[model samples]
Each structure stands twice: as C-alpha cells, then as structure tokens.
Target: MLINPTIEQHDEKRRDKMSQVSLTKGYWFFFEHEGNDISMFGSVWNGKENVSFNNEIVSSFRNLNKFKSEHSFSKNGHNYKVCTHMTNMLRGTLVVSLYCDDELLQTETLSQIGKDKPSKRFFSKTFLWFLVFGFAVGMLAGYFNLFG
Candidate 1:
C-alpha cells in the first residue's frame, strides 16, 4: 500500500523525536525528488507512489529485496543505490550507505543498544516439543481405548 508523503514525513519526525528522547538507536535513509523526500523503505521507494514510470521499473522495485546487502535502481532520471555492510554481527553494527548517480549521498553507522536474548527461541522450541509429546500421548490413549 502506498503511504502519503505528509504522513510519512510526520512519522519520520515522530520517530526521530522518540529516538532522541529515549536515546534509542535507529536510522533512516531517504532521497529527495521533485521537492518530495521519499524514504527508502516507504511507499515511494517500493514504487508504490505514483510516478511516470514504465512497468519494468515498478516490477523491478516490487521484486527487489530491501534487506539485501546491495541494490541499485534508477527512477525519474536519477540513479540510486543502497548498500548495507555488516560491521559486527554480535554487536549488531551496520553501515548503511546511499548513493545517487554514483555519488555518495549519505552513510550511517547504526548499532543496537544491547545483545539479543535467546529466551524467545528457547521458549518456542520447548513449546513445540511439549505439543509433540502431548500429541503422542493422546494418540497412545486413543489406540489403547480402541484395541484393549
């Protein structure tokens, strides 16, 4: 779904304010085209926003994986590229770089505040095992009732 530019701008500003207030680590990369700031992950970047583009570009954007390490696209007579580099996996250090027409536009290094907790993974595995055990016991009970 396409998002309105005004609403997108508002959300970006709000997120910026919240991050500043809480000192959280977050980053945004955007490009300016025709007096509008289009966020990289927003509707415009995904070719959802209305523009005079043929089907091929739109399809390319639609099929593109935003999480990939590198991407390059051209829209509205401008070339854009996004590159994500993993500096440290354990520390969650990421370097996001943006380039316009072969010129570097912006680069940001972002890191998570704390280490990831494994409790959620552990809980999910345990729950799956519990369900399997319960199902096995239920099947055994049904067999005994039918054959005994």
Candidate 2:
C-alpha cells in the first residue's frame, strides 16, 4: 500500500536502511509454471530484521523479467500471462498530492504527531500554568459571586 508521506516516511526510511545488510545482498529468485508459472523468495525488509514472505510485499520489481513469464491473470478480456509469482503480486503506488484541511484526519492519532509535546508547549510553561490557575479561580469567583 502507498503510505502517506507525511505519516509513513519514517516507516519507508526504516525499511530502506535495513535492506542493505542482506549478508547475501538483496537478489532475485525465479520460477515458472505451465502456461504462466511463478516463484518469489525474499524476506520482508522492515526497519528491523528481514521479515519473511508472509510479511513482505512482493511484486514485479523483485524481478520483472522473470515475473512476466510466470503468472497469468485476465485483464479487460485478454488472459495475459505472467511468468513469476511477483508478477501477480499487488504493488503499492504512492501518489502524494496537496491535501486541504478537509482531507486530513479529524481524530488525533499519535502517528500523526511529530514529537510528544503537549498542546501548551508553544507557550511558556510557567505562564501557562498561571493562566490555568487564574481561569479556574475566576470561574469559582464568578460562581460564588452569582450564587452567594
């Protein structure tokens, strides 16, 4: 899936960094079937360790040439065939465009935030504290002034 750059950039960075240490280097494996046979073997290169096929998003990029010769899928009406499992794998195409305030999430999730600073961080810690206290006291005074 194409992740939102503003949100998923960190994840992408992590994946790219960890992919370099493949002891054997990131390489491709090929296989073929009857009309369109296919095979793919690679560990999911997340930020951490190389995850297994179950976790990786295998696609044509893993090996495009071998891919076109293996798997077969019907498109429009034609039964176009592919040679590798990667050929049939789902691909993630990230399309980043300008988003307006209306397009953003209404809820506040931790992933959407940068650092864990509170809402009041922009203001001085001491002044903000006094403002809160003053607001509380003023409310109480107004209540007593009205009821009493």
Instruction: Give the Cα lDDT of each candidate.
Output: 0.46, 0.29
The TM-score of candidate 2 is 0.17
Candidate 1 Cα misplacement greater than 4 A, ranges: 1-34, 41-68, 114-148
Compose the digit string of candidate 1's lDDT tens values, residues 26-138: 33334444553434332312322122122122212332243335567677688777666656644445566667789887775654433343545535654686799899988
Best by TM-score: 1
**Candidate 2 residue spans exceeding 4 A from truth:** 1-123, 146-148
Separately for all candidates shown, the number of backbone clashes (residues 3 or more apart, or on different chains) is 0, 11
For 42-129, candidate 2 gives per-residue lDDT tens digits of 3223211111122222233333333222223342334433232232222211111111222321111111112443434423543676
Worst 10 residues of 2 by lDDT: 104-113
TM-score of 1: 0.44
